[model samples]
Target: MNNDILDKITFDTGGLVPAIAQQHDTGEVLMMAWMNRDAVLETLEKGQVCYWSRSRGKLWRKGESSGHVQRLVNFRIDCDGDTLLLLVDQTGVACHTGRHNCFFQSVRDGEVEIISEVEISPDEMYGNKSGGK
Candidate 1:
């Protein structure tokens, strides 16, 4: 892990960059989240995915509570150096809603449709935690 490369990333005014997580083998995009420098460094050092939660205002280790961990396979930066792509080996569900991926909605013909079914229930995933609506 090169600190020089990580330092070159141009974060937004809020000191955050968008990170898109994808399944390495399947190339399926799992989720998109925000990351700060600390999160990036932690992910690289720990071999697990970490994100900066705007709502929580802190570092969020993926699957800290749930068991659906993401093992880092590869990390990439976009051409602008403002965004990241993380190829990971996902363990269980990725979406907080108990879906495989966060992008489960499809917009077609002026209608918003759900493209995927929930693999696990929110109650089962987070217990009493309020899964984002």
Candidate 2:
């Protein structure tokens, strides 16, 4: 693939761009992550979603351990060239908290509330007890 496309993206000072992953068929917004130049190219080349982990400070291949992978269907760039939208085929829960998606919180009656339940336990997903978010 031609790498010239990446030059158009407006990466932040940290050389990162926010990427939003959405379900291709249902259009469900699954999760949000970050990506650097290499991560974007790797995802395009491999046909799987790869992200730059801000916390880990490394390239994080989706489903590297948990077996919940996100396959790329379509990749898009925002008009501002600072954000990305990835249309993906999500295999399982997208959130580390074992929820279906990341945006599981909502405000109802002026109070913050949890809107979703865990589909799988953290131990089941990652083989450890504390499945952090």
Candidate 3:
């Protein structure tokens, strides 16, 4: 619970650090996000995932509207000391597209094929929080 470890982390020029979220039990990578100092503190203290949205330019709580909250199981730091690995217990689909993970498509040979389909629609997952067009 010491701040020394967190203090050593190096942030990018934008004052944001990359945070990788992984499924704790399965060891599957869920997503990667940016976190500012406050986001980090908020996550640790709350045991909920938080990120600094680059596009939105604000602090976003994981599953704030989608109800796909990622509960923090364990938090880790890489050897290089620039990134964080958050082991999470995901509530629902991690991707906005309603897939289990963000990486649904893989490069097979030279063609990119759709290996999975959206489990739910954007409206169902994100609701009005996304402000659809």
Candidate 4:
């Protein structure tokens, strides 16, 4: 929790770094999000995944409202110190679309295809709230 550790990260010109969250046991990537310095410290301090929301322009704690919380198991910084890797225990579905992960689409033969199925409905996850997807 030292300031120096956080300072070592090379944030982008926008003062943000890309953080990738992966399932701890399976090594399956769940999502990719941005994290500011404060977010990195907060996640380490709180033992929860926190991200910087570019659209909302604020700190977004994972599953704060969606009930798909990500519990931090381990944290790693890439060799260049420009990116972060979060090994976490994901509860429920990681994607707001009610999928296990955000990467559900794939580009094969130059055609976009859906590779995964929705485990639950977005309405069920977000309580009939539109724009959750």
Name the best candidate (by lDDT).
1
Better of 1 and 3 by TM-score: 1
- lDDT (10s digit) by residue, model 3, range 78-114: 8887999999999988887788888888899999988
Off by over 4 Å in 2: 129-133
* Candidate 2 TM-score, C-alpha based: 0.95
Candidate 1 vs 2: which has more lDDT: 1
lDDT of each: 0.91, 0.91, 0.84, 0.91
TM-score, candidate 4, is 0.94
Model 1 earns a TM-score of: 0.95
Q: Which of the predicted structures, 1 or 4, would earn the higher TM-score when compared with the native? A: 1
Instruction: Summarize candidate 1's per-residue lDDT along 22-131 as a digit string, tens digits.
Output: 99999999999999999999998999999998998999899888878999999899999999999999999999999999999999999999999999988887777876
User: lDDT by residue for model 2 over 34-89, one digit each (tens)?
Assistant: 99999999999999999998877899998887889999999999999999999999
**Model 4 C-alpha lDDT versus the unseen true structure:** 0.91
Error of 4 at 92 (Å): 0.9
* Total clashes for model 3: 0
* The 10-residue segment with the lowest total lDDT in model 4: 124-133
RMSD of 4: 1.4
